[model samples]
Target: MLPSDCPISPLPRSAMLYCEIYAEVKPGLFSSEAKSQSSDRTMDLGLAEDHFSRPVDSFVASDIEQLKQAIEECKRLILELPEHSEKQKDTVVKLIHLRLKLQELKDPEEDEPNLRILLEHRFSKEKSKSVKQTCDKCSAIIWGLIQTWYTCTGCYYRCHSKCMNLITKPCVRSKVSHQSEYELNICPETGLDKQDYRCAECRTPVSLRGVPSEARQCDYTGQYYCSSCHWNDTGIIPARVIHNWEFEPRKVCRSSMRYLTLMISRPVLKLREINPLLFNFVEELVEIRKLRQDILLMKPYFITCKEAMEARLLLQLQDRQHFVENDDMYSLQDLIDISSGRLSCSLTEIHTTFAKHIKLDCERCQAKGFVCELCKEGDVLFPFDSHTSVCHDCSAVFHRDCYYDNSTTCPRCTRMTERKQDLPDEQDVGS
Candidate 1:
């Protein structure tokens, strides 16, 4: 009971056999009687499709509203799925894509103007060798083989490409004011229970139960973070650098890593005030301190001398102006340079240049130099000279051996006291 003009009748024996079986299974769909019914249903479906379809350019506020609702629905579905399951992962990926599309429709501008700090995000395909890296924003596993992600060069903030645009956290280097001080304590870990067993950065509930819930301690801040907030990144802690002079790298959270990186070049550490004994142990520190003191003493001569000014004698210390201005403060980079002997070598060169100008080249500078009072030697003696000693009372300089032999008393102070005693007393003159 196939229609006589039915396309199923191809005249081939194999085609006829297949049509006969289809006709028996359906009984009416291929017959002439059912053609009219099928035509009516097709027309109804086409009308419904036409009612829903619109031009792409016709998108309005209502479409955006619909997208928002769809995104919320997707989020709900994701929450209902089992955590860490493949189905949940797929839903999260879909949700991120939908969010990206919504953002494009809302702003259209590729670059946002309200960003606090622009980060140079460098992406890498290789996984971290030490820790299993997770997205800092989403707390999701960064599947290096399948997903592309970015790590900030300044702060070491890691996140997925999809999460990068959504990041609202400012780079640690952006807040220079807050980075002036450092936590001086060495790994002063506050117990996890005090933090309510949560990550310090994200407030994610963590535990000591499983690998996924393992909490990592930041050596700088001494706070626990989840794997997402801490990727086992290591940095030299400022406290260790200042107190112990230990430059060995230690594990820190992302925030601490960024903060330490910002503080690396800043000369905010008052090393003398923090650890005065450090100078006694670190030979480079002691030598640098002495050199800085010498530079300070030589600064006035360079300023007054016309020849030294024309030659830009202070220009040699342009990069290290703090060495002339302050004797105690040191930066992390300065400490590293001192340990490597680079700072000492550079300071020695500058010191030699300054000494040459003060003692030999400039006549005016040499005239300012002191002649030893005890020995009465014509040879010039500077306060910075190793064989010279300055009197605390009269600010006069003398040979170290001569000053010690004279009971550490200044000759100028003795003469001034005797002259005052020889003069008539003020009360007797008034009488």
Candidate 2:
């Protein structure tokens, strides 16, 4: 400690200040050696993995909302910190960790932040130890000992769930089965290895595996189509041309304009074709952004009939089977593109010619024309109004008169009465 006698001269003022600024240990930057710093960063980010690495099924909406709130709070804290404070640096590092967790919850796409708002999240039955250590997502080396992981139950591919959205891959074939009732019955082999069939339109070598992809089979036409070729079948926008575009009219449009951009940008994605309901939701937001009221005037603006909604959902399938995963239906690529001038269609255009099947839900009291089961032979259309009555005893809804005439009491109520009659009275039991 006898440094008072030491002859070392002081450095320049700038150098001394620089050292002082850097001398304080930063949040994520743990050490001077590159290897140590790298390890430190990994550990810092791994906090999320430890907390949220549970199977997707285990997480409820509340848990997800909590994580989201935490992320926002962290951002706020960081913003309030002084620019040069070590606390500020630490908070920024925390923000990165939080963002990565949020990313795991989204579908992959281009510059657009999220693919869609996933209402129900799905996860594989398998986890880190059961699956491979390599990330199927980024194809980066991920050590299982250090990081947690997830696996696809359909393809058995191990990756971070977020990684599932990054690249185009074949569709999962585990759910396909023969449908005898299907009028159009041509199906080429669809197992993972059969990448031989060519798309009818684009002639891209297609695989039934449905990876990035092969021909999408048409059970209606007995044909297979590549994703781009199927775009013609979907009729969203005229083949990638910003100008002179003609969007084909459709009752059930699968992919959105934003989805096309993601495909072009080359992010692997695991998703099903979106149902019309979800698509219209995205479009409505677009309408609000652009102030286009035309969507309100459209015929199918509101959907009341569950049967009709199911019919539109049927249009989402390439074939009459559930997809292993739905492709990203949610994306802001069209808006992003319009803003960046990559695609045409201004926000203000009443008819951007999207051919979008915009839809709305009926008000609670407005539903009508439901077939009444009680009027079995006559098959009358029962309005949800005066015509409808729920049984007091059984809670079954039926036409009011039909229920009263056929049986004064519901069959379930009658059975319940008979059962009560057979039971001993409480007084008798006491005696």
The estimated TM-scores of all candidates read 0.63, 0.19
1-431 per-residue lDDT for model 1 (tens digits)? 22333343332222323333334434333334432212112111111222223456755797667667766765555444444445544444444445545655654432322232344333333344334567878877664433445666556677765677677567665555554877899998888899899998888787767445778899998999888788899998888888788889999987788788878877888887888889889888889988998888888777887898899989898877788788888888899899888999999998988898888888888888788887797588887787888888876778888888886458789899988986778758888
After superposition, the stretches of candidate 2 with alpha carbons farther than 4 Å from their true spots are 1-67, 93-431
Root-mean-square deviation per candidate: 14.7, 27.9
Displacement of the residue 115 alpha carbon in candidate 2, Å: 26
Clashes by residue pair, model 1: none
After aligning candidate 1 to the native by TM-score, how far in Å is the CA of 159 from where it should be?
7.5
Instruction: Quote model 2's TM-score.
Output: 0.19
Q: Poorest 10 consecutive residues of model 2 by lDDT?
A: 175-184
Give the alpha carbon lDDT tens digit for every residue of 189-289 in model 2: 35423434776544577776776675565422335666654543332332212221223332211222222322322212111222234334344334332
